[model samples]
Target: MTAISDRPQMLPEQFEEFARHLGRTVEGIRLEFINGKLGIKPVPDGDHGRIIQWLNRICIQARPELYVHDQGLKIQGYRGGFARPDGTLADADAFVGRGDWATTEDVLMVAAVTSFDSETDRRDRVEKPRAYAEASIPVYLLIDRDSAEVVVHSQPDGVRYESVRILPFGKAVHLPEPVGISLDTEPLKNWVR
Candidate 1:
């Protein structure tokens, strides 16, 4: 009989170090700090950019007294360092400075529009959620272009997130406390194709 693989997987810390080292050498590409590890993601496709633009427009239409970062915003965790969510919404005063905008306590929601490989999917689906949860950033949204789905996670429990909800295209997902906005994905479907 063939033996099944039983090798131990690398720890989060080890991955973190590798990611950090790679990030230092790499340029142009966007990298996120996940659980002390570095996660490099693609520059995003047209569909992803379209969705982000749609969300930004919606937020502007609503005008909820929140600060929205389409692509240039960076969110930093206590131990992990920094991550740039595709679209982040927080209190207007949460972001400060010109060249380098630092995240503050007023920040609440962080969202990433996913359109990359499996490793990036795992980072966005699992690692980033935990990182954002630990940072106590009320809401974390993951928009998957492949499946045309939006996953909203709220209620951070320790280093993980809870109350996870998956909303497919054509549906609307309402963000919970900290961010009381309803995100309609119906319009986003047009951008996917």
Candidate 2:
């Protein structure tokens, strides 16, 4: 008698491999596997890269209990996918690797600087916030270049988030966890434009 078998489960490592392959094979399609689904978006612009760099500098200077990670760092979700935030703050020791670092229990925060389009904003402000909350990341920051504002999301409830605070440009937003530090907006303002 023939026996039934379960489908092959894809782990985070395998999913990353698939993403790398697709990134090379696909044309003009920038895809990232996030929250067990493929998050496909167009490449970001100069403003996006600037914002990411600015935040990375600030985070590193702050020297929170967590290490500050810039580009090339990916955060794996609770399911089988992953998301590469513009900046991530996690335990320094957890992020040691040659190419990509594995998500660890100490990864407390993830931030995405949005500059693509309305759809990208929606994904960063709404969808990704929910995904990070579900992943149990203590904090999620969304920097909107169009609006020149930062949205800090905390207190995860199920798949959603609470304690939503919006900090407009020219104001300092204090992040919760690892260390209590405020982010200056002067640099972002100067470069965003």
Candidate 3:
């Protein structure tokens, strides 16, 4: 067998340094600080944008008080996981300045449209939800292109969500009280490979 992978694990402070480096070098493509490691992801594609727009429209319709931000959500906890979801719903007041991410406490929900990339798939389904929960963000929405389905994760307990609801493509998924309107998922059909 080949030698074990030698990618050095990044310490917390080191992760912070890397974040700064990314800021200076890569402008549009954001990196993830996940479970003490820095992860690089591909820029969103056309299909990804469609899903993001769909989610944003439904979010505003359901709760006018919430702002649907495309990317730019950072969880403020010791573990240091950074999330730039395809779409994030936060209380109107959460957006204060020119920063990339908003405060985790003020966030209502986060949503990501899965890319064709496998690394991104794992982050969207597993790592991101866990990190968002750990920061106590209330809801996690995942539109998985691989399975052609949507999953709503709620009742977060730091490491995971206690409740999970999955729905196949073209079916509407109901968000909780704060977001009273349902997401019309028919557009998901157009996200062709």
lDDT values, one for every candidate: 0.69, 0.69, 0.75
C-alpha displacement of 114 in model 2, angstroms? 0.8
Clashing pairs in 3: none
Query: Candidate 2's residue-wise lDDT over 111-159, tens digit each?
Result: 7877656577557876688777777778888887778888888887757
lDDT of 2: 0.69
Candidate 3 C-alpha lDDT tens digits along 1-193: 5333433367655765677777788865667777666777878888888777777777777677777776466676545657677777876667778376556766778888887776865688778878888888788888888888889988888778888999998897887644555887888988957
All candidates: TM-score: 0.76, 0.76, 0.86
Compared with the true structure, model 2 gives a TM-score of 0.76
Best by TM-score: 3
Select the stronger candidate by lDDT from 2 and 3.
Answer: 3
Candidate 1, number of clashes: 1
lDDT by residue for model 1 (25-144), tens: 886677565444555677777877888777777776776566577433334454435667877786555565533334535667888877667786677777678777877878888887
lDDT of 2 at 78: 49
lDDT of 1: 0.69
